[model samples]
Target: MRSLSLSNLLRHHKHTAFGHDDSHLPRQVIEVAIDDSEDTHELPARKRRGRAQSTAGTIKGVIRRASLSLKGMVHVHRRPSVTAEPSDLNQQLPNGRPTSAHHTWNRLRHAAPFRRSRSVYGLNGTEDGLYEQQQLDHQMPIPAMGDEPPYIPMNTGAAAKASVALQNEYYNRQAMHTQWLQSASEDSNDRESGIGIVVTEPFMESGVSDDGSMLGQDSNISRIDFIKELPSELAIHVLAYLDAAALAKASVVSRHWNEVVRNQHIWRESCLREMTTTYATSEPVQPGAGLGIPEIAPSKNWRQIYRAKAELAQKWKEGKACPMYLNGHTDSIYCLQFDEYKIVSGSRDKTIRIWDMQTLECRLVIGPPEVVNAPNVLEDAEGNPTHYVNLSDSYKAAPSKPQVASFAEHHKASILCLQYDDEIMVTGSSDSTCIVYDVRNGYRPIRRLTHHTAAVLDLAFDDKHIVTCSKDISICVWDRATGALLRQLRGHTGPVNAVQMRGNTIVSCSGDFRVKLWNIDTGRNIREFVGHTKGLACSQFSEDGRYVASAGNDKVIRIWDANTGECVREMRAHDNLVRSLHIDSVSGRLISGSYDTDIKVWDMETGRQLLYFPRWHASWVLSAKSDYRRIVSTGQDPKILIMDFGADVENIEMLKSANTGIGGIRL
Candidate 1:
């Protein structure tokens, strides 16, 4: 029970009564305690009287490590019974043989990780017939790959037949140990230190000393920590291959290994190389790249950072999240977008609602000014005046609905699409028009662009131009500052469903089964991407505007090269039409919502479906967006579902710049 170091234990083990000459031999004695109730009748002669002539005179139950005698079979020497003949010993009844020895050797044999094959130890042979008897002393078959040295010994001897008893004795002792384990398996630890043996099972497994022996005290061989002896830089390089789990195990090997595991070099490799998302602490910064902001914490702990990333990645991989519902929308939500502070959604109910991120309350609502602010329902409210009890409280009437609503300045039809930045907010409607408002100026109306003759299905804008696609088979571009119609891009035979603008490039997908690229300034059709067999519903430009991704009624997402019009990647997973697709380049992930009522996440680069969320909406999913911490989606079920995957991470704001596109998960 004492806390002793390996050095003190080895010192005591070395000073055991063996003389200098005997101690120089290869094998040393290990003391094994014999169970009191052990049956000695089955064994040849089970008692040791006096080793006065030998070195074991002071110890009572000391047994030498099993060795091969002169015969080809193992010849174990036990108590010297003067009455028993060598030949008669073989005929002795096999009843009550010590199974403890068999259990130990069998355990060590199967457990040695194959340092020595069963053939070398005659383990494959029975007590009746020694099939692969050891003829040479200590010599074994060559070590196999991934196995280490200090090969376990096998039977040896041609002169001695009954002496094959050493292996049997070893087998006998191990058998009893196996019996003890079985009977005491119900113990809390499943360990039988009830005998007070100093060598516990874990100690025997992990406590090997310098020479790879049970106790290297008596052996003349010297061993050193070659890993520690390596140059410090090389040591870090070697430790890099051991992942987080292996590194944890290696840390306790010694103080040297612990320090190496704690070194910044080790964790820096994990954060920069192993992690998919870039850590703010290690990422390189470029001018005007504000996202490359440093961590808010004064000092960084690389190890803690890696641990956090690993845990969060696992949560995403497992599709683990907590859900919060926004239940205001009365009809199918056609389009929505959000930043870190609030969520804005437009629905078929002819209203646009703004929800606060923290309070989850609708802060503002925009609807038609001429119509009464009342929900259109088939329910007979007059007949329901005498309503009875409902199925549950959840089916009861609404208790707290928004009291005030703002009338839309221009939209007379359903608000279908919207986008916003710091300066202005833009909303497109089935009225075939787009209304721009000062986002920071109390939602003040800026101007209206009514160039399209049909429903404005989708819209995208940058600093220079507002791009809108329509059901009238037209794509219109307007100056953001002047409200001037810049270009009327028309090429598709069918109505364009989605449009995205980035710098000089504009990408659009139409119901005519074509995805096209355009030069915003000249209104020239740069290229057309041809892949989908059915109408396309959505399209977007990559961060660099070099690649385009589109999805639609075909239920597949295709990525294309803008310059060559070549289909570069196709992601196929959804069973029904994929209605929406959003590419987050920072995280390198594609967020998808399907008409099958599912929202799925994909690795854009690998085209692998990392995972999908469980069904939370009863109707078609219309839109979905994801960041590092959360994924927000809406459906025809008229519910807004916000699932927060990284809700537990405290400093999650650090991940705002880079995306988790390559984040690894267990799936």
Candidate 2:
């Protein structure tokens, strides 16, 4: 395991982190270590021995064992004891030689990977033993033949001079360390005395079994998971060399491998190096506003979390998914969304249902409150609600509030679209209104938005604004806190079927065959996209507001560049009108639902269709949304379809803990 451990440690961090081939790391000492290793590793060990030839302590026992086991080869090429280099191995060492310090470094560097393969070694060609490296070393140019200049070409003048200088520096540092050790040792006699120098004979001679058949350890050594014999800290240090995939494979070898591989140190490094997550965002990040990679919570199980991320990614790539049906809604389901705890869906059954995410049990079923009529509400000739009470201060002062119309808990009509954050849930409906529910307080009705004249087709909200599009060919922007109409946008010549918001920008698709961008605050047109040959039913604005996506009667999805108002990509796969589309900004996948009864996932960047399901919904697929784990789609079918990418991922709950919010990825 020692040689296997050393090789993994070097290959993983050295070549992988410091990148030699495609890497420009100042520490390219690696490529030299494998192909042309000669200098740095040996200089320090040789220097220490030259200074205190007789002094020994902890190193004495180690050297004795190494001498017996390795038979004499260890001294020339490998680290036999504690090593100090010019500094770095970063600064102190020259030719990359694996140091005991490098091993510790492999531990430290891997100990805490931030969000950020192996060469199998040994005679067995498994990464668990160390025999063949002895044979492989002989293949390298035989160490130096007593100072015959050098094997690396010194034919070029500049190359020769530089090599000479580096060689000189190597000797100079070694001499300095030797002198320092000599000075330090002169005063100390407490260490092992140099008098009785003990040495041992090799286990085999004249082509005998070096497997230690003579010592009876042959059975033990052959079966040992070499890592088990080392101290706990040392074992962890050794295991750190293996990547997540390798660590997982090593765990099944034996109980000991399983135990050592579970070390918090090993997985912590793996998580940091491989795990990544994003902060909770109610909506896309606004311009000049962004969240950095979220730090993993220390309370979670990182190993299971790592595994789930790995498997889920593969599942998405291969279009492998497990399906579960949510069948509570009695009529066509129009919209749905899920978070860590629950799935909240709105349906044409005039109801809202929240399903427990894990058990698929109906947690709560709510619908429009019983209302006699819309109270004290008047409409203009165009049918827009004219008289709406600003009830914030009224409700705050008088805790017992009077009914604001017998309004929507509040959708009195079929709910069309909805969005929720931690505190409240907002639903739009054919009732020409939006209702806000206090999600934290038993789903109580709080505010009502009566700004649209026609059916509210879709809605999106952020911290400040609630944006809603309507079949009235108008879009209304409202203040989230006060429920006051902020701005009414009028541009689409036909009913605005879908709307999406990212920071200050809003994207809306209309039946008029046009897609437009608008500034939520200024209420002015930013740009317009016109590539669809027919009406657009659904649209999405990228998190950065640089791209817009829309689909409708044209039976295709067009990716638009918001700045240029140009359709950049026309992704065609649907056999009928595409109804709903969403982009998972975290994964860069475009999920679309269509009347064709198909839902397809696309690589938004490449404009290539990745996964497609023919008839995922039995009828017109109305809406679809996704995160890293699953895609949630609702359609003309009474049932909602959940394509759970994590269904087969073991210990999925642990993965959810790390995925605190949407758009987080662990790879």
Candidate 3:
């Protein structure tokens, strides 16, 4: 028969005493120790063989002994040694062997009757509620001194309510972690297990200890740095979606996140997205043109470039400007023209002065020329002829007609209007003639054609011809090569104020309140646009010659279809008469100056005002011109106002306006 040990009987009694179930316990094996020296001699060969065959019967005998009622056996096998150290603690017994400590604790702790208490584990007062309340306190957003209010996420249409719900949910999950820690601290029995154990379920009074391992895992997750674990490539890509303002704020999150966000590609893509598209032609100089700024470069710092544009726009919008005094012209400046290099202004002082834009120095002044004849010669000591003072005098036969002092005495009266190209500059004047100067050849007068009976008001030219409008109510088409009047246009009943020509089309505005489109070669009116109630001041044909824009004393600007003469749109833009107008086809911006002392920039297509400089001119702004760098305006005030909007602003305006309509988008 199999024999059982005292320890095994004690384990059986402990299970029964605690009312613990053991129905699923594994089958037990009973071991009987025999002296090794007498094992084979004591048993017969046949008896030993039979013992080996009865191994199965021995296992069944142990199970039958365990099946006996433990209450009957406890009286026989109850051992007090289990509470102390036993010699056979490591010895194997029937079923699994129970250690001494396991037997002692099982008997002492499990045998006691279960009791419910209001508190346990030394926490009986507010201390227990304090831990729970502190965990819940995390749900409130702490007020920070200057920090922006928290960005509460919204998951529904009721943003405020949804955000509150989300905020609560977020904090509750966070509170779960703290509650888990409190539960862990309250249970002294669990900590002895080790870090490998965790409790996932949240701490609740009902059964927090049941899933303590799960709760530990949930709490430990709060310590993970999620953003820090993302790959740098993905981190940067995520940051690229943030706007400039948010990106600056995110950089302060942490050192590791900051480092990932500082990746150049992230800022590059952001800068590129915010920046307007720039074209090479919009720049003052081509890349190799040897000018102040090149159109293209091998590399670029996108951040600085974008910042410069943003700052420039900010300053312009704020009307923050440092006025530059170009102290020159003694009298009111009547007409002005400028390129990137210099500003050529005509003043009532009867002089045309060129001022270097960069140096702000008067480069040169062209005034009426003086003619001096050679003095009469006197005989020197060696019989060589010399002048009375020193040099010899010379003489040539004079012409029959009284000649003007010099050919370059360009005007007898004030220069009224001007137009120029790279090679030549043409100026019209009250002298009743238009003079063409060779700008490449010392600015000397190349041709002087007398055609108008009164002061010339405006002029435009190309390589082949120069067209001039005058107060005499006529337009003269002149041959650029020779001082010959090619054709006379005489249809206007009033003085023509402004005129512009493109290819075969000539558009002119007159005091008759009419905008006439003329064929320059034939000197005949192709069409007429009549809309202004008062006299027209300026007119221009669009570059493609499909449309014409006109503005005048009517305090209105109108755009008309060139072919059909249909009035497309009209804008009442000024409180006073508009004096001059210009259009930039590339940017689609129309600029107008008025007697109101204001200069406005407009969108020609939509007739929407984009920007306006109010009282930018101390006096009436007579004429204004704009390009990539600046807008140069000269008026009844002698001082020239150069509004430097910074380089490449035209490109920015173009990009920002490209997709807009009336009441359009703005940067």
Cα lDDT computed for each candidate against the true fold: 0.61, 0.62, 0.58
lDDT of 3: 0.58
Per-residue lDDT tens digits for candidate 2, residues 488-565, read: 999889999998888788888899998888998899997888678998888887766667888899898888877888
Clashes of each: 36, 7, 13
Residue range 365-401, candidate 3, lDDT tens digits: 5656531121211123565432111011243111111
When 2 and 3 are scored with lDDT, the better candidate is: 2
Which candidate order results from sorting by TM-score in descending order?
A: 1, 2, 3
Sort by lDDT, best first: 2, 1, 3
Each model's TM-score, in the order given? 0.58, 0.56, 0.52
Error of 1 at 202 (Å): 18
lDDT score for candidate 2 against the true structure: 0.62
Q: Rate residue 444 of model 2 by lDDT.
A: 74
